[model samples]
Target chain A: MDSRVLRTRRDVLTAAMDELVEGGWDAVTHARVAGRAGYAKATLYAHWPDRLALVRDAFDQVGRMPHHEPTGDLRADLVGELVSFRTAMTEHRLDRALAVLAERAGPVPELVEVRRRFVEDGERPMRLLLAPVLSGARLEAATAMLCGAVVHATLLHGAPPTDEEVEAAVDLVLVGVTGA
Target chain B: MDSRVLRTRRDVLTAAMDELVEGGWDAVTHARVAGRAGYAKATLYAHWPDRLALVRDAFDQVGRMPHHEPTGDLRADLVGELVSFRTAMTEHRLDRALAVLAERAGPVPELVEVRRRFVEDGERPMRLLLAPVLSGARLEAATAMLCGAVVHATLLHGAPPTDEEVEAAVDLVLVGVTGA
Candidate 1:
C-alpha cells in the first residue's frame, strides 16, 4: 500500500478505537468515525464497508497480551500471568468491547472468533508454564480457577486485582494444585 | 390484588420475559409486550410505565437462585453451589441478560442494583458454608475463584461445567485453601 493510504487507514482505525473506548459499540459508526478521522463517509466505506469491519480492525490493532517470561518460580509466574491478563483486558478495553459483542444480536462470526482466539492465545503461555505441575483435566481446572479470579475480580470490583489479591489467588492455586 | 389482576400481571411479565429472551433489550418495548400479552398498550403503560419497569419485574420473577442445602461436606457443598449457579444463570437466561445489561449505556440504576443484590445474595450461603474453613479476604478470594470458574467456563465453552470439571475446581479450592 502507498504511504499516504497507510497513514489514512491508521488514522481511521485510531478514531474508531477512540469511539469505542469513549462510548462503546453503539458509538462507533462509519459516519462518526469518518467525522473523527476528518475523512468523507465514502472514504470509510471504500475501505471498511461496515461498523463490524471497522471495529474488528480496531480490535486487531489494540488487542494484545503482555509477554511474561517464566522465572521457574511457580508463585511468581502465576502472579505474572494474572498481572498480564489484567493489563491486556483493561488497557485495550477488551472487557468493554467483549461485553458489547456478547450482547449484540448475531455478532459477526469473525469477531467472535477473534475473542476466542485472544482467550486461547493468552492462556497458552500460562498453560505451558504449569504443564509440569498439572495436565489434562487438572490443568484445565487450574487454569479456569486462576483466570476466573483475575477476570471476575475486575468484573465485580471494576478494577484490576491488587497485588496482594493476585498473590493470594496464585498461592491458592499453586498450593492447592501442586502441593507446593 | 384481585386474582384476575394478578393473573394479568403475571401474563404481562411472562410476555416481557419472552420478548427479552427472544429479541433482547430493544425488543421489550411496552407496545410489543402488550401485544404479546394480549392486552391493550395502555394497559402495559398503566402497569409498567416504561421498558425498565417491565424488565425489572420480569427479572424479579425469573431471576432467583436455586436453593441448595449445604451438607457440611465442604467439597460437596461447593460443587452443589457451582451446579446451582450454572442452573440459575442458564435456565433463566440470566447470564445472557446480564452481559447485555452490563454493556448497556447508562443502565437503569435499579436494574444494576438488582444484579448486585443477586450476586451478593447468592454468595451469602456459600460464605456461611465456607466460613468454618475460610474467612475474611481469603474467603472472598475463594468465592471469586469458584464462582469465576463456573461463570467463565460457561462463557468460553458456551456450556456449563461438567461434573468432573466442577469436582476438580472444588477439590483445588478445598485442598488449596484448607490444606486438605
Candidate 2:
C-alpha cells in the first residue's frame, strides 16, 4: 500500500472507531463513518465492503494503542503496561466498543479470530514481563493470573485501577510461587 | 402473593432465563418467555412489567447459587469458591446471561446497582475466607483480585477454569500478602 493511502486508511479507521465509541457498534455503519471522516460513503465502501470489515479495521487500530515493550523488571514493567492499558480503557470509549462488537458478533469465525488475536496481543507483553520474573510452571500461572486480574478489574469495575492494586496483585502471585 | 401464583411467577422467570441462555438477551421477549413457560402473557406482565424486570429476577436466581463457606484456610476457600463459580458460569446459561445483560446495561444506575450487588455477593464469602489469613488493606486487595480473576476467566475466556488454575491464583494472592 502507498504511504499516503495507508495514512488515509488509518484516518478513516480512526474515525470509525471514534464513532463506535460514541454510538456503539451500530454507529460504525459505512455512511456514518464516512460522514465522520469527511469522506463519501463510496470511498469507505471502496476500501471495506461490509460493516464487519470496517469494524475489523477499526479494532486493528484500537488494539495497537498498547505499548508492549518490556522492561527488565517484570513487576514494574507489568504494572506500567497494565496501568497504561487500564487508563485507556477507562478514559477512552474504544474498550466498550470492542467489547460490544465481540458480544454481538457471537460465534462468527472472523470475529472469533479477531478476539483471539486481541487476547494474544494483549497477553504478549505480560508473558514477556513474567518470563524473566518466574521460571517453569510458576511463570505460566503467574502470567495467567496477572492478566486475568487486570482484565477483570478494568472491564467489570469500569476503572483503569490503581498502581497499588496492580503492585499488590503482582506481589501476591510472585510471593506464592517463590515462597519468598 | 398466593402460593400457586408465586410458583407460576417463578416458573415464568425460570423459562425467561432459559431463553436468555439459549438465545442471548435479545431472545428474552415477553411472548417467548410466556410460551416457554406455558403461561399467559398477562401473567408475565403481572409479575414483570418489562423485560428488564424479568431478566433482573432471573439474575437474582442465578446469583443465589450455593456459596462456599469459609474454612479458615484462605487459599483453599478462595480456590474452592472460584472453581465452583467457574463451573456455574459454564454449566448454567443464566450466569452468562446475566453477564451479557450487565455489559449491555453499562453504567445505567439500576444496572450499576445490580452489578454492585453481584460483585459484593461474590466477594463476601471470599472476604470471610481471607479475613483470618490477611489483615488491613491486603485483605481487601486480595479479595478484589481473586474475585476479579474468576469473573474475567469465565466471562472473557468462555471456559470453565480448573481447580489447579484457581489454586494457583489464590496462592499467588495469598503468598504476596502474607509473604509466606
Candidate 3:
C-alpha cells in the first residue's frame, strides 16, 4: 500500500520474473526469491502466502493481454486475431508463461484449471470469431489449425509473423477450413 | 547393474514421474523423490546428481516416441503421422511431459535446448515428409500448421482424433497448404 511496501512488492515480482526467465517456473520459490530480492522470508510471506500465490501475483502483473475486436470482416478478423495472439506471445511474455504452465506433467487439478483458464482466455476471441462462421468439429479444427500455426510460427520460429505473413497463413487456414 | 540397483533406479524414476505429474517438473527434486520412493537422498543422488538429471532420466523412460515412417501416399502418410502423434500424446504420456517442459517460462539455455530437441524430434517426420512437397516459407508454414493442429486436436481436444477426424483434418490442412 505504502511506497516502501509497493517498492518491495515490485522488487519481489521483478525477481520472480528473473527467476522465471532464467531458471523456469519451478525455480521460483519463496526462499530463492527472497534471496534474489534481498528480502527476508518473513517479509515476502507477509505479502504472499505461498509459491502459487507469488506466481499468480507475478503473472497477474501482466493481467490479461489485449484481444482483438472483430471488425465483421471474416478475413480481416482472422488475420487480426492471429496478429493479436502473436503480439501477446512476443511482447507480453505469454509464450514464456505458457511454457512454464505447460511443463506440469502430472494431473494437478488446480494447475489444470489454471492452465485451462490461461489458454482459453488467450484464445477466447478466436473461438468467438469462428463461432458465427463455423461450428462443430470444423470450427474446432479451424481454431486449432490457425492458433497452432501461430504458435509454431511464433515460438518455434521465435518471431512474430509480419502482416503479410499473417495474411498468408490466414489464407491457408481459411481455404483449408472453408474448403472452397 | 545388479537387480537391486536396477530396482532402485526404477523406483526412483517412478517417483519422479509421480512428482512430475502431480506437482510438475519443479516438484521432482532429489530429497522429495527419495522420500516419495522410500529411499535416502544419498541413494537418489547416487543415481541422479540433480533435478534435471532426475527429470531427464524419468522422461528418457519414454524417449523418442515412435514417429511415423512416411508412406509414399501423401494423404496416407499425413494421416498416419497425425495418428501417430495423437497416439504418442495419449498412450506415451508425452502430453504430460511436454506440459512440464513447457511451463519453465524462463530462458534456461540447456532447458531451451532440451525443449527444442523434444519439439523438433517429435515433428521431424513431418518436416521430412513436407520438405520435397513444399519449400521455403510455404514449407515452414505448412509444418507449423500441420503439427500445430495435431497438438491442438490432441492436447486441447484431449482425445486422439479418430481416423475420420484425422482424415478430415489432413484434408483441410492439405488443401490449404498444397492449394490444389
Decide which is better by lDDT, 1 or 3.
Answer: 1
Comparing 1 and 2 on TM-score, the stronger one:
1
Task: Record all residue pairs in model 2 with backbone atoms less than 3 Å apart, i.e. clashing.
Answer: A172-B172, A172-B176
| TM-score, cand. 3 | 0.73
Among the numbered candidates, top lDDT falls to 1
Whole-model alpha-carbon lDDT for candidate 3: 0.72
Model 3, residue A103: distance off in Å is 3.3
**Ten-residue segment with the worst summed lDDT in candidate 3 chain B?**
B102-111
Question: Per-residue lDDT of A1-180 in model 1, one digit per residue for the tens?
Answer: 999998999999999988876676678999899999999999999989988789878867665557577898877888887888787768866566555555553234555665666567667887887788887667877788788776666554355577777777777777787662
What is candidate 2's lDDT per residue for A1-180, written digit by digit as tens? 999788879889999878766655566788788888888899888999998898788787777665646667666777777776676666775457645644554534466666666666766777777776576545545665666565555555555456777777666776775784
Task: Please give the distance, in angstroms, between residue A92's alpha carbon in candidate 2 and its true position after superposition.
Answer: 2.6
For all candidates, state DockQ relative to the true structure: 0.51, 0.45, 0.37
Please give the distance, in angstroms, between residue A81's alpha carbon in candidate 3 and its true position after superposition: 2.1
Backbone atom clashes (below 3 Å) for every candidate: 0, 2, 15
Collision pairs in model 1: none
TM-score of each: 0.88, 0.86, 0.73
* Candidate 2 stretches greater than 4 Å from native: A68-71, A105-109, A135-137, B69-72, B107-109
| Local error of candidate 1 at residue A50 (angstroms) | 2.2
Give the per-residue lDDT digits (tens) of candidate 2, residues B44-144. 89879988788788777667766776676666677778876776666664345545554565634466566556656766777777787776546655766
Best-performing candidate as measured by DockQ: 1
Runs with alpha carbons beyond 4 Å of true place in candidate 1: A67-69, A105-110, A156-160, B105-111
